[model samples]
Target: MTDQLDDLIATVQEQERRLVLTRFTHDDAWALGSLVVGLARERGLPVTVDVTRGAQQLFHAALEGTAAHNDVWIARKVATVRELGTSSFLAGLQARARGEVFEDAPWIDATRMAGHGGAFPITVEGAGVVGTLTVSGLPQADDHALAVEALELFRAG
Candidate 1:
C-alpha cells in the first residue's frame, strides 16, 4: 500500500507539473467548465463542476442527479487545492505516504478543507496556481479523473 501510494503521488505530481495553462481568464474558465460539463454529459456522470480564480468563482454547474451537497464538497476540495498548491488528490496521497491523515494536520480545518480527489490547481505559466477546477458527486478518484481528463482535452485544443 505504501509503494502504491508513493507511485500515485509521483503520477499526480507529474500531472500538476505538465497540465499548466498559459493564462486563465473568465472566458477561459467558461471554456474549461463547458468542456468538463460536456464530458460528464457524454459519460452520463452526475457531478458538479466548479472553476475558481483565487477567491472568485468563475463558473459552476450541477449536472443531473447531483445534489446541492456536491457544491459543499467542491468548496472543501477547492480549499485543499488553494492551500496546497497541488491537486487535492496529491495532498491526500502525500499525507498517506507520510502515514498521516490529511485532515489531522494542524493547519487544516476539516470543515473548510478536504484532501479528497477532485480539485486541481489551475496553474498559469508564470503566475503559478491562480485558481482551481473541481468536480464532485462521484467517487473521489473518478471525480479527480474527470477533472484531469477535461483539463487534458482543454489543454490539447
Candidate 2:
C-alpha cells in the first residue's frame, strides 16, 4: 500500500479503536441520528444519514436538496460495512490501490456491496462490528468524514 493510503487507514482505524461502545441501544441511534442531522445542517450540506443495527434500520433521513441517488449510495455503502467490518473508505482505497473496481472484488457481492466512502462500522467494546453509521451526498472522503464527525460528537456527548 502507498504511504498515503496507509495513513488514511490508520486514521480511520484509530477512530474505530477510540469509539467502541459498551452497549448500543435504540436510543443511541436516535442520538446519533440527531447529531448527524445537526452536523449536516450546521454545514449546510445536502446529505442523507442512515444508522442501523443488524437488519433493523433505526434512523434514516435525507436532507432537502440531496439527490435521490444518495439513498442508493447509502445502501451500497452499508453493504460494505456489513461484509467488510471496516470503513467503506478504506475498502474503496484498497480496491483502488489494487487497480480494481469494487464490483469485481471477490469478497462480497458487487451488486449489493460498495467499496466507497460514507459508511463506518459501529463496534461494541468486545462484540466487534454490530451496526453501521453511513452518510452520503458529498464527495466520498467528505461523506466518510461526516460520518466520523457525527460519531466523534456523539462520543463526546
Residues 37-106, candidate 1: write the lDDT tens digits: 9999999999999999999999999999999999999999999988879888888888888888999999
* Worst 10-residue lDDT window, candidate 2: 102-111
Q: Give me the displacement of residue 20 in model 2, in angstroms.
A: 1.0
- Candidate 2 structure quality by residue, lDDT tens digits, 42-154: 98999999999987999999998888789888899998888888989888887777778877876768668888899999988889999999999999999999999888888
Candidate 1 TM-score over all chains jointly: 0.97
Give the least accurate 10-residue stretch of model 1, judged by summed lDDT: 1-10
In angstroms, how far off is 70's CA in candidate 1?
0.6
Model 1, C-alpha of 33: deviation from truth (Å) = 0.3
Model 2's number of clashes is 0
- The per-model lDDT (C-alpha) reads 0.93, 0.87
